[model samples]
Target chain A: MRIHVQNPAGTSAFSFTRAQWDAAVKRHPDMRDLEVTIDNSDDGWSAALPVADIVLTWVDIVGAKLRGCDLSHAAPRLKLLSCNSAGVDRLAPFDWLPRDIALLNNSGIHADKAGEFGLMALLMLHNNMPAHIRSQHAQRWAPMHATTLKGRTLVIVGLGAIGGGVARLAKMLGMTIVGVRNGSAPHEYCDEVVSVSDIHKTLVRAEDLVLACPLTKDTRNLLSRERIALLPRGARVINIGRGQLWDQDAVCDALDSGHLQYAFTDVAWSEPVEEGHRLWATPGLILTPHIAADDRDRYNDITLDILFENIRAHAAGRPLPNQIDPVRGY
Target chain B: MRIHVQNPAGTSAFSFTRAQWDAAVKRHPDMRDLEVTIDNSDDGWSAALPVADIVLTWVDIVGAKLRGCDLSHAAPRLKLLSCNSAGVDRLAPFDWLPRDIALLNNSGIHADKAGEFGLMALLMLHNNMPAHIRSQHAQRWAPMHATTLKGRTLVIVGLGAIGGGVARLAKMLGMTIVGVRNGSAPHEYCDEVVSVSDIHKTLVRAEDLVLACPLTKDTRNLLSRERIALLPRGARVINIGRGQLWDQDAVCDALDSGHLQYAFTDVAWSEPVEEGHRLWATPGLILTPHIAADDRDRYNDITLDILFENIRAHAAGRPLPNQIDPVRGY
Candidate 1:
């Protein structure tokens, strides 16, 4: 059984010490006879692999690197494709791969960090931090009444790992957690769960809405102008998921008109946003370079743990954890 | 027994209907009659008998009114003085008044509202809400990292009613709550309590500090420049109490220098702070026009409850609740 490791650009995984690699190798004794190959080239997957059983891939940047691979040509011996990312959208469209090839994802890796960011967004809006900062700079004490989360409603757009983490924390803070997902199912942390179809109606009642869904064909531009307009005045929003899921122009217009009191986003349609973006000039807006899930060490450690556990399960011929369904696009 | 109601500036209590006053008088059978009088006139105290059993005074604007009256002349009749406000600063320097006069105040009236404001300030600083609002108006999706409260430390400067309320809520959110008061007594909601002498050391370890202490002669400018400098960089501060406890120039300098991340203040040293105040130009500072305890209906109800309860206790020859020690100036 041979293990093939494909490294992504800018990943620090390449700097792993030989001693660490040996320790990891020793943990998997069943694969002691395995020949490991570290490939970091465009033609890394071009050669036919008749004996390769497991493929470990760490791709952070979305685009051609992971998706451009021709998986159909060498699907026979590929037992598993473990991705070091929570989102598998980049690999969703590939239906030509072997049916038996198990797909595992690092779902738990980013949950805590992303959830922390979500909580930050909720609290910042509730307290009106940005206005305070501006006031400090102006040496002006422009007093404003701010809202509190104790009796406010928080609507979570998705209830997966990241959203679930957020819901748990918000519930702990005495907030009413309302979750909106594709199906109507009871979630542990959510006080109420509504179907995605009723999202517009849900928005009207939510004091704060968190966008935590994946960017899929069904959810693309989910929070459009019509939907955003349904929210109550002074409602705050936080987007820690895909940016394309929201109608940027509508959000901007609502914010400018003071219809939506505040918005905190950690994801953008484009990375490293250009200068003079509308967000830069908008009042009551907080912008940061996309670094919400930037605890690289913790994320990598959790990802590796998940990968190791899955590998052990595979060796024992048991079902792997965090198995992703290509059709679901989670 | 008879009751004498004195209000220097004509209390809003006078707005109560005659029927309502009659109903209250009927409820307390120990009182034979009720006399409402404006205490602003020089001869106001002369009209009331020296043997009047109970006196209720409403003083909206603190200072002078309570001190100007010759309470010693009316001490024989004035068994109890029920004040309408929470702070007894205006009634301080009470040595000149009758030593036996029992003074009761409405201390817990603003608990919930002020607590909510403190929570709002914490959320705003943690989530950077104002920046997000600004971003939304610009139609920009700027991603930023936010701090969460799950594992942060909160240091409360005062552990009185308002501080206690804030500590309770913060503890529920999984934060470590530290309190600073005049003594080192253990607090119910706080994990640790330190004396005022240890405040500088305590500030160094706090991630978020709330100033809820009353402004007394000893507490004036309690958070001096040297003390503010002891705080860790990025520490957030919220002042729901009198702002005189914090040196405005020190806070402004700290915020401008990025030594302190944020400050939320509901009360300032001066009301309607002058246009060129340093607080107006400081960055990451939130100013609210001292309205944290402004839930009109709730405030009125609490005040009435305190007054009614104190009156009942006084009529029954019981010790009054919330008795203020003028020397301490609580």
Candidate 2:
């Protein structure tokens, strides 16, 4: 199978090199018989796309590279599209996605890092660290109280890879973990799992809320103003999914009204979160420029593992891992 | 036995009410026959201390009540001194403390809250949240990469109430937990435990160092300039135990030289952490006036539990739950 990697957004990005591929096949003997050709590049990658059966691209380069490159005319043989991000919300704007193509995301690999990010966000909010930081900047000595994590209820939305990791951490800290997802959770990290329909019920009991689901039509703005109101006043939220999933204005209003204690996000509407935005001034809204779960070497290692596993699964004609439920958006 | 209640701190601190004492006696039954006298006041508590067999006081008001009060002459029969604080450093100034006096601190009461504070400190340092907050204030969108918490090593310098809780939380977050104290740890929350003699060896392996032991001769300046230098460059430090354990100036220098990634302290030598202090301007230093555990309800709950247990143990002539080592401090 011919694989063309679209290193689109300038500089280098996550890719499966020929050497890495050979090592993978060597490890996974089932794929030893299949021949593989890789054309990884940034500049003339579209030229090699026509002969490719699979394309390793990124979620961030849709507008810059994917939009300009005509997929049907250039990559007629392409049967699969593997995204670089663990979450595929970056593919939302790509309306021309081929229906016949298989889509896979580099998930689970980033779960450990993403879970740590979620935990950090929760800790910062619960401990009143943001207010402490503000006081530190002014050199003012005003200390605020922080609630304990033990025995507190954490409602995790979307009990997937990242959510599972977060649940395990919270559980270990003596927190009562409840998960919210499309259906039942197959894992055992959380104390209980509730359906999306019962999310409002779960929100009332949640001292901390984590949004870890993927972005899709159904999940976009899933946490609406009404749902946020369901979370009793002063509840903390950490969103590691996508910015569009939150109604930013509603969140800002909740924070302003003190209805929400803190809303920390690693995902935002815009990547850089430019100046003159209301979000910058939103009280209790801790803005992070989306650099959670980083460590390039580790990131590359996890991504390579996922890539290798997906390739072996595809070659063996087995159901692919982390294959997004186009219907659920994760 | 005559029990005179010493309520010398002006208002109610963490004291058992007459009704509470009655209930405690009823609950224990063994202490029901003791003659309990009411001397709950600041003005004349010293006069009643002479006849007291046991004195219940607080850590915050030790000096105001204990300094001019002649304990040896007034309370020759004193068998136990119960303090309403997790650590007994507040009791260090009294050189006249009778050698026979069994001192007890309301330890393990504030562990959950203090542990949460420690977690917050680590998260803020690891995620670089202070810089993000600074950028938010400046309306800048500068994003920086963060190191993950998993697989990192954490050295908890005290495996007591607060330190053990912190170790448990850190371990749950996927960190390798090593503990350091005057001697061996009694419980098993950490991956390993070492003595103070082996602290330097442990410091070299610690990515994060937490000072959770009390202030004492051996522990004061425990993370001295020499020991601070022993830590790996860019190591993070969190002080929830006492501020004097760290050489603040040395920590500031470490932060200035980029030798320490972050230093967050809930406790300082001085409580309000006065203005014009170098710590206010120190790079990567996150300071908060010591309010790690400020839930009055929880405080009272934990204190009452300790009071009941200690009273029962004292009446039954059993060893106290949190009898501090006069030499090792806590």
Q: State which candidate has the highest DockQ.
A: 2
**lDDT (Cα, tens digit) per residue for candidate 1, span A213-261:** 8778789899999999999998888888777889977888999999998
Model 2 ranges off by over 4 Å: A8-44, A62-73, A93-95, A184-187, A325-328, B1-40, B43-51, B184-187, B293-296
Stretch of 10 with least lDDT, candidate 2 chain B? B7-16
Give DockQ per model, in order: 0.24, 0.59
Candidate 1 local lDDT, residue A326: 67
Give the Cα-based TM-score of candidate 2 against the true structure. 0.89
State each candidate's clash count: 37, 1
The weakest ten consecutive residues by lDDT in model 1 chain A span: A9-18
Alpha-carbon interface RMSD for all candidates, in angstroms? 5.1, 2.0
The TM-score values for the models, in the order shown, are 0.76, 0.89
Q: What is candidate 1's DockQ?
A: 0.24
